[model samples]
Target: TLENIHELALGIELAGVRFLWALRKPAGTGNDEELLPAGFEERTRLRGLVCTGWVPQVTALAHGATGAFLTHCGWGSTIESFAFGLPLVMLPFIIDTPMIARAMAKRGIGVEVARDESDGSFDRDGVAVAVRRVMVEDEGKVFATNAKKLKDLVVDEGRQEQYIHELEDHLRRNKDV
Candidate 1:
């Protein structure tokens, strides 16, 4: 997954789309910073912001300029993207990611980056293409529409109170235990 970061970084630059990347240090590296593509920051300075640690994802997503979310298909990331009505560019790494990516793609709120079958290898071109699909190309509209619908689902009227009452009823019944 660390390997893809460079390619993804390069991909974003190559695609020329505005982005906010929350980067973490790569594994097994002694360096203080992640090994991003050389000069990626300077190259993308006008259009992108790359942070090393502890980015406020919710705040970033809530901003007016924020568009699509490029994620590793983590469940929380998926929900958060949808909560903000941002279409997902799913770069699934492992485990339940593949399943969630598949579902999101099927639901028309995501576009997946292509990967090799056996080794999970993906190239920068694939990342660029997927990013463009979600951020620059016309097809992004469908994904955005479906994502907004998901936002509605999450924040729909009575949704929170219904779950709260359900939890309260269960807790009251099990208080003695």
Candidate 2:
């Protein structure tokens, strides 16, 4: 996984795109400092950020400057992206991720990055192409539009209050029983 991160960094560089990468180190040791390829930072100095710890996902997603969310397709991330109306660069790994990727694609709200195989292995070029397609090209705009509409559905005040009332009713009914 670490190796792929390096390759993706290289790919991101090659694609000539600006980026912000929030990285976490492998868990085998206590060190939290990310061990990205040497000079990766300095080399991409003009175009990228490689933050080495926890990042504020909601804040980042909400920011006007953020275009797409390159993410692991974890449930929390998927929902958050939808709520924020940010188009997704779905990189699903682990349980239910593949399904989520497929669903998002089918829904017209995101694009699933290509993998080397169905099992989800990938290289730098694939990462580059995916990023470019989402962040730099024409087709990606459709995803962005759809994502905004999806976001509007969630943020609609009437819809939100309805859900809250439904939850309160359920709680009250349960309390009486």
Candidate 3:
């Protein structure tokens, strides 16, 4: 998720949106923050930075002010975005990330940066381009609209309870059989 904040910040800034990249300086991990390339900070009109943990990060993302999620495409984060009805700016860092991006794209959940396999790098330019595409492009709005619809489904208590009860009954019947 730390990488997510970093990756998203670039895109958010490029899309002319206010942005932040909150990170956790892991205990004794000795990994320095891989800073944006020279001049990027100035060019992108960089905003604030924070060193925070997961709960607070999720809290931040769920806040009413949060319009979208620029995330790493972890299943947990993906679900969280869905729960909050926040459209995603997915940047999958793992092998599964591309898959998640593809699926979410289909469902109008988010967008991912294109990878350059030759260098194994997502340079600032690429990140900026992807961010704009997802945040400002028409596809981004479609993703957000779908995300809101999905969130409504999740928040419908009556539907949820019905589904849960049905699941429980089905389980009980199977156990008896």
- Give each model's clash number: 0, 0, 0
**CA-lDDT, candidates in order:** 0.87, 0.83, 0.70
Instruction: Report how far residue 91 has shifted in candidate 1, in Å.
Output: 0.8
Q: Lowest lDDT 10-mer window, candidate 1?
A: 25-34
User: Over the stretch 70-175, how does candidate 2's per-residue lDDT look in tens digits?
Assistant: 8889888888998889888877878999899889889887777788777658877888888887788897899899999999998898999999999999999899
Compared with the true structure, model 3 gives a TM-score of 0.73
Q: Estimate each model's TM-score.
A: 0.88, 0.85, 0.73
Candidate rank order under lDDT: 1, 2, 3
Question: Which regions in candidate 1 have their CA more than 4 angstroms from the true location?
Answer: 32-34, 163-177
Clashing pairs in 2: none
lDDT of 1 by residue, 1-177 (tens): 567788888878877898889988767777655578778888889888888889998899889898898998899988888779999999988799999999999999979998888988888899899989998898998889999999998877699789989999999999999
Tell me the deviation in Å of residue 89 in model 2: 0.7
What count of clashes does model 2 give? 0
Alpha-carbon shift of residue 90 in model 1 (angstroms): 0.6
